[model samples]
Target: MPDNERRTDQRLERAILELLDRRAASATICPSDAARAAYEGDDDGWRALMEPARRAARRLAAAGEVEITQAGRPIESAEARGPIRIRRTR
Candidate 1:
């Protein structure tokens, strides 16, 4: 991957963790939240980071730092499709 992409990925991951930290231990945040936090635009620039945000969540999940949830239940990253949320791993 290119340096810029790597940097963006890092930022997304950091943003995800930070956003999760601000919420209750049982609370969760959507990937779009992290994308929006990483984005510096008032426009639709955050849309471009949505996929990267999901991937960042998956990476965090693999590290046992976060959980990927759908319908308020934890789900396997591979099975996590459609809407999902991120919460700190219990």
Candidate 2:
């Protein structure tokens, strides 16, 4: 990947981490509103921002920085529904 792409991926990962941190601290998030607010942009713009974040989050979950549970998948702060809440692992 190019430098810019790497940076963008890093940014997405950071954003996802921040959202997970918020959930860890807050317990729950209103997924629909949170997603809209976090990815405030038109369809294409939102997709551009969120697709990267989603990919990054998956990687992080695999790496164990974030925990993923089937019962309650970490909420993708970019989607209104369907996300299980994600939490930071000890």
Give me the candidate number with maximum lDDT.
1
Regions of model 2 farther than 4 Å from truth: 25-44, 69-85
Query: What are the models' TM-scores?
Result: 0.97, 0.56
- TM-score of structure candidate 1: 0.97
Candidate 2: count of backbone clashes, pairs at least 3 residues apart or interchain: 7
Best by TM-score: 1
Clashing pairs in 1: none
Against the hidden true structure, what lDDT does model 1 obtain? 0.95
lDDT of 2 by residue, 1-90 (tens): 999878777766666666666654535322232344455466645555554555665677678786544355554344524454445654
TM-score of 2: 0.56
| Whole-model Cα lDDT of every candidate shown, in order | 0.95, 0.55
> Candidate 1 lDDT, tens digit per residue, 1-90?
999999999999999999988888999999999999999889999999999999999999999999999999999999987999999998
Which ten residues in a row are the worst by lDDT in model 2? 28-37
lDDT of 2 at 40: 46
